[model samples]
Target: MKDVKTRAETLRRTIGHRVVDGKDAAVVTVSQSYPTDADDLWDACTNPERIPRWFLPVSGELRVGGRYQLEGNAGGEILTCAPPKSFSATWEFGGGKSWIEVAVIPEPGGYARFELAHIAHPEGDHWETYGPGAVGIGWDQALLGLGLHIDTGAAVDPSEFEKWSLSPEGLGYVRESGNGWYDADVAAGTDPDAARARADRTIAFYSGT
Candidate 1:
C-alpha cells in the first residue's frame, strides 16, 4: 500500500461559490498532475476499458451528447467533449443533478494535470455540515487510484481498495484528505472553526467512525 500521508497530499483541493441557473452553487475542485502526456491521460479518463482498472466500471455511449453511468454510481449526459483537453458533463445521482468539468492540461516534460470540478447547489444544511470535504475527499480517493494505475501500469483490485478504505491505514488517509479540504475551505472564506468542525464530521463519515 502507498503511504497514507504522501498519497493524501498528492491532490490539491479548492472550494468556490457561484450562481448556476439562478441558484447558489458550491464548487469543489480537486486536481493532481500525472506523469503522462495529455492524450494518454485523457484516454485513461475517458476510455471505459481503462477507467475500470482505476476508477469505477463505467458503461454507456461515451461521446459528446451521449449518456454514461458508473457502476452503482452517478449517470449523466455528456455535455461537451474536446479530446485531450477537457469535457463537461451532468452528474446525476440520488435524484440530484450537478455539473462536472474535467480538464487535462499539458505541462512541460510530457506531464499532464487532471482537474475535476464538481458544482452542486446546496438545498439544505448539507453544505454547512460537510463542506467541500464531502466530495473533495471522495475525488481524492479515486484520483489516488488513477495515480497508482498510471505510475505502475497495474490495475488496482477494486475489492481490495474498497476493503482498504475501511482499514486503519485507509482511515488515516481519509482524515488527511479531509484536513486538506478544511484548509482549502478556510482559504475560500469559510470560518476556520466552522470549517474544522465540518471537516471532522466529513472525515468520520468517510472513515466510518
Candidate 2:
C-alpha cells in the first residue's frame, strides 16, 4: 500500500452527537485532502465503473431516488445529489440503516477535500463497545485506496487488502487509525478509559486478531 502509516495519520476524524428523529445518533466524519480536482474526485466517488477500482463493485441507478448496492456491503437509495460537490445516501446493511453524506470541496492549494459523514443511531451498547473507530478505521482504509488510485491510476486489489490488513504494517495502520478515533471519541465526551478499551476491541475486530 502507498505509505499506509502516513495515510492513517493524514486523516482527520471527528465524533459528534445529534438528535436524529427523536433518537440519539453518532456522526462520524473523516476527511482528507488529495491531489485531485473536485470534479474528478466526485466522479471517482459516484461513478459505478470507477468505484470498484478503489472501493467496491457497485450496481445502481445514478440518479436521485435510485437504489444502489455495493457488492457484499451496504445498499441504499440516493437521497440527494448536487454533483461535483455533495450528495446524501442511505447506508443499509446488517439489517440496520443509517445515513451517509459525501462532500468534495476544492481547496486553495490545488487539492480536493474528500469528506464523508456517517450518521447512525447505534442499537444497545454497540457504541460503547466499538466506538467510532468501528467505522472510522474502515473509512481510513477506503480513503487510502482512493488516494493510491488517484496518485498512480492503479486498481487496489480487494483480496490483497484483506491479506495485507492482517500483516504487520496493516495492523499498525489499523491501530493508529483506531486510536485517532479514540481521541475523537474522548473529545466528544466519552470516558477516556472506556474509549481506549473500545478502540482496542475495534482494532482487534478489524485486524482479525
Candidate 3:
C-alpha cells in the first residue's frame, strides 16, 4: 500500500443523530480534504470497477433511478447522480431504508473536499435493544477506509476492518461516536442521562468493557 496522507488534522467534525418518533434516527457527517483531483475522487466512488476497491463490490446501472446492489452489502435505488460532484442513494440495509449522500467539492490547490452523510433510523425501543454503538461506528470506519483507499489505492475489507472496531482504539472511537449520538438524542428531546447510560452500556458490550 502507498503511504496515505493522514487526514486526522482535517477530519473536521462528527455530528450525532436526533431521535424521532421513539426511534434512534441519526446522521453522521465526516469530511476530509484529499490531495487529488475531483474527477479522480469521483470516479473512485461511482465507477463500478473502482468502487469495490474502496467500498463493496457494487453492480448496477450507472444512472439515476437505477437499482444497484453492493456485494454482500446494502442495495438500493439511486436517488440522484450529478457526475463528479454529488451522488445520493437510498441505502437499504437490515430491512430499513436510509439515505447516503456524497459531495465532492474542488479546492484551489489540487485538492478536493469530500463529505459523506448517512441519515439513519431514529432511536426507540428497538434502537435501545440493538444498542447505540452500531451504525455510526460502522460509518466512521467506512470513512476511514475511503481515506485510506483514496490515498493509498488499497482496499480494506469491511468485515476485516470491523474487527478493529473492537480493539482499544476502535473502542475509543465507538465511545466517542456513541456519546455524540447520546448528545444528539438529548438535543432531540430524549432523556439525556438515560441515553448516555444506554450508549455506555452498548459500548461496553461491543468492547467487552
Clashes of 3: 13
Per-residue lDDT for 1-209 in model 3, tens only?
A: 22222333235445466664566666667677788899998988888888887678889876899999998889999989888899999999778888888999999899998888777775356566534345555555566677778777877776666686666666666666566556655665667767677777766665776
Tens-digit lDDT track of model 1 for 1-209: 76668878878888888999998899999999988999999999998999999999999999998999999999999999999799999999999999999999999998999999999999699999999999888899989999989998889999999898888888888988999999999999989999999999999899777
Q: What local lDDT does model 3 show for residue 23? A: 69
**CA-only RMSD, every prediction:** 1.0, 0.9, 4.4
TM-score of each: 0.97, 0.97, 0.73
Poorest lDDT segment (10 consecutive residues) of candidate 1: 1-10
Candidate 2 residue lDDT tens string, 29-103: 999999988988999998887899999999979689999999999999999999889999999998999999999
10 residues in a row with least lDDT, candidate 2: 1-10
lDDT (0 to 1) per candidate:
0.92, 0.91, 0.70
Against the hidden true structure, what lDDT does model 1 obtain? 0.92
Point out where model 1 deviates above 4 Å.
none
**lDDT for position 76 in model 1:** 99
